[model samples]
Target chain A: MPSAASSQLLDADFPTRLREVAGMVETRLDALLPKPNGHQSVIFEAARYAALGGGKRLRPFLVVETARMLGGSLDEALSVGCALECLHVYSLVHDDLPCMDDDDLRRGKPTVHRAYGDAIAVLAGDALLTRSFGILGEVDLPADVKVKLVTELAMSGGMSGMIGGQVVDITVAEGERDEALITELQAMKTGALIDYAVRAGGYVAGASETELAALSAYARDMGLAFQIQDDILDVTGDAETVGKAVGKDADLGKATFVSILGLEGAQHRAKELGERAKNRLAPWDKAAQTLRDTVDFVLERKH
Target chain B: MPSAASSQLLDADFPTRLREVAGMVETRLDALLPKPNGHQSVIFEAARYAALGGGKRLRPFLVVETARMLGGSLDEALSVGCALECLHVYSLVHDDLPCMDDDDLRRGKPTVHRAYGDAIAVLAGDALLTRSFGILGEVDLPADVKVKLVTELAMSGGMSGMIGGQVVDITVAEGERDEALITELQAMKTGALIDYAVRAGGYVAGASETELAALSAYARDMGLAFQIQDDILDVTGDAETVGKAVGKDADLGKATFVSILGLEGAQHRAKELGERAKNRLAPWDKAAQTLRDTVDFVLERKH
Candidate 1:
């Protein structure tokens, strides 16, 4: 069933492409983040510090790769990628606050709150979140497309999505085992933003309704697979390799896929979801090869 | 020099009009905010608590009155006003957090952090802020106009604006008697959003570039006047009248307009700025009467 383009894409070096997109997004993030130099420079400095230098740039990779797959301009996709990265980084910064996760380390470095204190960390997270939307205003897309992107990001990041999931994560009773709640939480907290990144990539490309639907389904599966893999990693990953403390979720007794489903069961579900995600892209054929590879990478990633 | 329209506006029941707008914006905010009833309903409940039934609604008043004067649709303007109010409420929620201002009361009610705990309070603030932009997407404006509104709001609420000023406010050493720094802080913290409200009103109506410029200058003066008045009230007003603890600024040794300019000097400056603000609206004559009265209201408000 594979066409010439599919064969070419299959032969493509996906990890290399992912790294290249990551580099491009980091540069864009650097350019977009405000330079620190005034009385308020401390906030900007902390925002930059929190946003730059670390992580796999996985969300940005999704954005850029999906857009590129759909024939959108690389540069426009890069801008959106940076915006999503800022949002993801902001969530991390706030989650690390003393009253939140209280984590002191992220990516082998001191967290924003640890490095700059709680007030600046809070402001820096806020500034980055605001700047994410501001970056959309500067993208070279048409007005309607930009508006759609804003709405999508806002919805995904707001109460019904990431923040909703976070509230549940913090408020759920200890040792309470509810598979449905955990599933919904995973879908909302991490999955919503992942879904947004993919859909935004499609939006930037003016992808057809059919294409968008397929992208949505693909992302839904990928997001679940991603979360399960994350749970697996947390159970298996060491602090040095994972770039932050591991086993905290276990220590906190937070419900995760690996908790609800044993490690083998979680891995099985991830594999099944990854296959479904890749199959959803059958229409795109060769252009979807890299995305398919991404699913595999997510299922296999050690950190 | 006052036009007939100006005379009519001047004679208008300014307080009644302000209250009406506040009521309208509150209704819209209620409609826009996510409803509670799920596992994460606590966050929604907290967000609703933070956003509803408090404060003067002065910012919403500015947005509506300005848009109405320029012949924009009332419904559309109300949506924008609600969005601005949500952003405002988000700032208040975060500013009252333990690591921030450590306030126990807001508008005579328990602050969000006090009512919902620090974690939920942070999530509520984040949710409200995100919903603010989501509201903009539903407004009945042209796509480009909506894009402009998003940019305006994002910029006004971000590092170069409100958050920037907030960082400076907390980071500035106690008893730091820098007049210019205080002015910059006031402009960034409060002036930016106020300016956005005015200009967004203009954008909604497709106001001429010249009209927008006039609105900007008027809002700039009005914002400074508003802050000076706030500083004055903090010094002179009681907690019962102010609806929050008063004299906290003095207690904290923070250098406010009252501290830097002295009570009389600050009062004189606010009056001068109010007059200048009113003068900036000379082009609109009677149509701007409500706005002109707003300047007087800002200068005269006890709390």
Candidate 2:
């Protein structure tokens, strides 16, 4: 991990903060899920396994941190964070299905289908996706906020958002590979959920339209930087450290950022985009420091 | 087709009404989804194939009729109805995957995976599932109603609901078969969505708590009747009329109502449950007449 950007900000223990957010998110996820004691205990167990104990929790971190930055309650923000993470995990579970990405590992462990069966994994994913909507029905929050969050999640998480991108990805993998298509795919498949995460945080906090717009721009740029770097890492990184098979994208003949732009070009683009993302938050003061560094971290992440 | 219950009610135009609702649902679904124009158009095409053209739209029919009975606008009820139907289609698409039910046919046609391949089918299911939540963020309804609908959907459709039942169904298939287990499985898988359909209709229509309770009870009984009869049909119905593979449960060694209770016992139970379902609606007047027949129709349906 590049320590420079995160270490320099707000006397930041950047790793510590990520770990803290992940801890809180895991606890919330644990509470949010049903215990694995029902007649269909295996499904619940599989769902819990898919969601509960791993990953960086970066999306939830965005929701929690962004909400807190805009004067939202940690408790409520955490709820929304948990919901988004549930959805994120759901997508991962499905993506790893035998018919999809067909990965045997996720977040350094055997994927849900690998541990359980494909049938349970599919149901587990379905369960997680459903929870994303249900968890937002917080009576304490203004009803409009709840509706807005659900809409944001659905629009980004659904057809025109994540799934659409996934469709494009599958098609591209099967046929021709191009940078423009890859960009669109990354935007839809990955960026959409990231957009939802940040916007939801700001939405619940009642951020001004201007603030929301800025956040969107910042998130879009940061998302691009993250994906390009991810592609680059896939080409150059190690499987053990990356927690998945690396060089797999190239092996699959899928066009990626590193394919369209050479490794050096992609690295340059990521840094520039990270800078642009941080610059969008120039209006914010000290509270925005972590977000700025998050962009930087995205630019520099190895996995 | 058994025309007994449908022939007796609403000028004996019950079949016509059902057809009308199905048409309306198809039109609405067509409008809701994107045209297949993108580079990844095949997935969109497959999604449309799954959702746009067919099915009895039984779930939406319940939603529309129940809402109309409770004084909700047909148009708005249709919105919720479309969302529910979309989710139902999503479940069907995923369930038919090779790793799950592995059926090659559905709704008298090739399954989505058969027509569009597995990757597209997976993405199509995800798109539909996401849209179900996204569409509910309509500006027209009260925010509380939207939240309630999303929550209701999530609860019924999620782990504790439909997906949970599916998990149990898959697990039971791998193990021993039993009536008690089958009943529990049916409740979670099929009954939860059925419950959500009726309860959501009442919820959006501003039904009182007691009214919602009655609707829940009625839907529960109707759902059980529907599932029991479905199991019976699997034993006795023809594959051509039933659309997909029948005798699948028996071939898979899965416990079902027919397997547990025998054909006659299951049929008798379904009739009794249908009667009980109708009795719950006694508190309503003429408006609920269609719903009562719906219960009868559930008992009498051949496929």
Candidate 3:
């Protein structure tokens, strides 16, 4: 699909395709979650509220598209995709809590805590987190593969990964000039899960070791570029356009790629990394066209 | 070990044995967690504080003893035991948060939020929850078995289980009591994990379906007996002996077995359940002697 004829993602209505997949995930999630009724049903409502509306669904898209690229079953990939999205949303819900990021707005809507009181919001996130693993375990795949996927997802999001990264991000002193620490923080905070998205698809598709490694290289570079672009957007994008709080990083004087490397430098690095990421799929030829286009989109996305 | 020759549990120091296992789990948790030296080291410190230095280790002990009874490797069961404990402690940490039960102390120490601030405490629980899955994934076993274990753990502790039960416990209205709802609440809130502890051991040991069913029956009754005895203790025991607040259930006007059945009625019920639970293990006979003894201990213990 990456042939010159398909080089333009617009040919396939890229945003339209993303929206459809996002919609599909929303439906799947709705069906998978416990209905909001009975005692403490508010948590289910809150969990649905946190997961159902808004956001780009980028991680789920990666799982589905990558699995499709590797000739895996779309249905199976979608199941795992929903699990990934549940995890991502769980993180967002927790991050927006008053005790955490203290944000009231997310995706042009009130954050879970703001909408449903802090206590319910906390339970919503916890329920969502637990639900993700349960969903993964229920996927119709070979047991071993499912186990590996759960393990990968857990490691990527656990203490040494996404959650761990968040801890460091919020604790670091302002104006510290340690680029190494900054990179590690970003790698753990965001890169770990993004890398796992690609890896999860590869595992589901039974990709060989060499193929999986190649996928990892592409994902790693893409994740870095994605974060760089994110930092750029945080500095340059408006809250309305970004659909959430922005410039807070600057206001808080948090170290970012754009802060250490000048704006132009960060942009240049993002472009270089994006290209390298797309190039890693060259061995797979046109089969990885969607992924190649994805890297391009990541660097170019306004949000 | 519960034979006439081994009746000297106090002489052999049963509490001492419990403490030793608790100590071992603490060491393992210490090794499993991220070292608390980085920017957000407090989360790690708090997670350690929440998980270590507390509790009866009843869940972990169940895993170890059950697996040993089924001839599974002690090392494998202990690994799973620690994972279960991580999950249990995570619940306690979150439950004690200001948004939930709002308790100030647990296991005779300040709650995580009180000690490390609410945000760090929240993150600590999140980290520990994530860490539990990571640890389960890392266990040295067949991938399929590990997957089954993870799947079972998630199901038992997830929205449909412990978390779901906690949501109900906090949200249900005062009085207007029903025995069925009360039983459901206690089962989901406490029994689910205990059932899984036994089921986890059986899975590790690769027990036959008959054996697993037998284990499940024993766990189910034992859990009920344990909780009933607990309610009795809350009414009869003091803060100093209980090591945490007591009488809060009655204070909150919550409907418990003691409230519904009356104290004497509840005590008689616990004894009946304990006897039934012990009888279920007759097939394994002397092999399940320790578990039988545990049921007896649950009925008679002061705290």
- Please report, as a residue range, the 10-residue window in candidate 2 chain B with the lowest summed lDDT: B1-10
Q: Residue pairs in steric clash, candidate 2?
A: none
lDDT of 1 at B247: 94
Model 3 stretches with alpha carbons more than 4 Å out: A1-12, A245-247, B1-17, B37-40
Once model 2 is optimally superposed onto the true structure by TM-score, how far is the C-alpha of residue B258 displaced, in angstroms?
4.0
Q: Each predicted complex: what DockQ?
A: 0.81, 0.73, 0.67
Over B1-303, each residue of candidate 2 has an lDDT whose tens digit, in order, gives 223454244346678889999999989889887888776677778889999878888899998999899988889889899999989999999999998879898866899999988878877888898889887886368998888889888888887888888877666554565766777777888998888888888976889999999999988898989988888889899988776579998997766787778889998899888877877887886568788878767767777
Can you write out model 1's per-residue Cα lDDT over A1-303, one digit (the tens) per residue? Answer: 343334323335777888788888888899998788788888888998998887789888998889989999889999998999998999999999999989988877999999999988888888888888889988999999999999999999988899999988888785774778888888899999989988999998999889988998999899999888888889999988876579988887778888889989988898889878888989988778888888878877787
* TM-score, first chain, each model: 0.93, 0.93, 0.93
TM-score of 2: 0.93
Error of 2 at B133 (Å): 0.8
Best by TM-score: 1
How good is the docking of model 3, as DockQ? 0.67
Contacts from the true interface found in each model, as a fraction, amount to 0.79, 0.86, 0.69
Residue A113 error, candidate 3, Å: 1.9
As for model 3, its CA RMSD to the true structure in angstroms is: 2.8
How would you encode candidate 3's per-residue C-alpha lDDT over B1-303 as one tens digit per residue? 234334324334455666777787777777887777766566778888898876788998888889888899878888899999999999988998988889997876799999988888888888888788878888887888888888888888887789878878877775655777878888889999999999898888988889989888988898989888888888989988876579988997878899989999998899888778888887876787777777767777887
* Poorest stretch of ten by lDDT in candidate 1 chain A: A1-10
Better of 2 and 3 by TM-score: 3
Assess every candidate by TM-score: 0.95, 0.93, 0.94
In the predicted model 1, the residue pairs found to clash are: A6-A286, B5-B286, B6-B286
